[model samples]
Target: MKKIILSISFIFTFVICFAAIVADLTGTWKGLIKFGDQKLELTYKLKAEGEKLTGSIVSSYGEIPLTDGKIAGSDFSYKIDIGGGPQESKGKFMGDSIQITSTFGGNSVTNTFKRVAEK
Candidate 1:
């Protein structure tokens, strides 16, 4: 029926638009986290292929590989083990800002990331 066809078209369009928004996370993000006065600068570089995200974190320690990254809508979750134990992060995107909550070493730290400006 006409109504059914229209409904499917609308759903498809919405899904494509949402996927584009999720893909926008691909690139470099920089943020600083403070742990009791010890502040560290971190950079995240992400790549999107379909709903899977591949990226790495760069800090003073070096580059840390991100594992099992996946995205749905505007939310994403990934894991990495650095220094201590396995760290898990859940991130949400708002405009040009990314808010992430990372948990590791029995503590959780939340940081805001801004997209790196391109030359």
Candidate 2:
């Protein structure tokens, strides 16, 4: 009985920690991507409400709507369709930094983004 109670408590603690890790990703993050000599600026806006998550991405070209977005534990995946061409991205949510892998034209880039400060 005592062992079972301890196991339940441990499970509860793990669940809370998992939720908190994903919740920390609720904000804007900015970073730069370098391709040899060219550097591009990237921005991500993520919002979480209850168990639902939504967000968008803005770059120099334009804004892309993130669809079918969901977060589980500290992992997240989202989809974006650019003019009918579909793309999928997955990333790990860190406390202060987020690393996402995205593919374009058969090329993929993984970027690290730091959380933007709220002003």
**C-alpha lDDT (0 to 100) for residue 38 of candidate 2:** 97
Instruction: Give the per-residue lDDT of model 2 (tens digit) for 12-67.
Output: 99988877876798999999988889998989999875455689999999998788
Candidate 1 local lDDT, 64-115, one digit each (tens): 9999998887888898987676778999977698999988766888899999
Top-TM-score structure, candidate number = 1
lDDT of 2 at 11: 97
Whole-model Cα lDDT per candidate? 0.88, 0.87
Which residues of candidate 2, in runs, are more than 4 Å off?
49-52
- For candidate 2, the lDDT comes to 0.87
Give the Cα-based TM-score of candidate 2 against the true structure. 0.86
lDDT of 1: 0.88
Top candidate (lDDT) = 1
lDDT of 1 at 24: 89
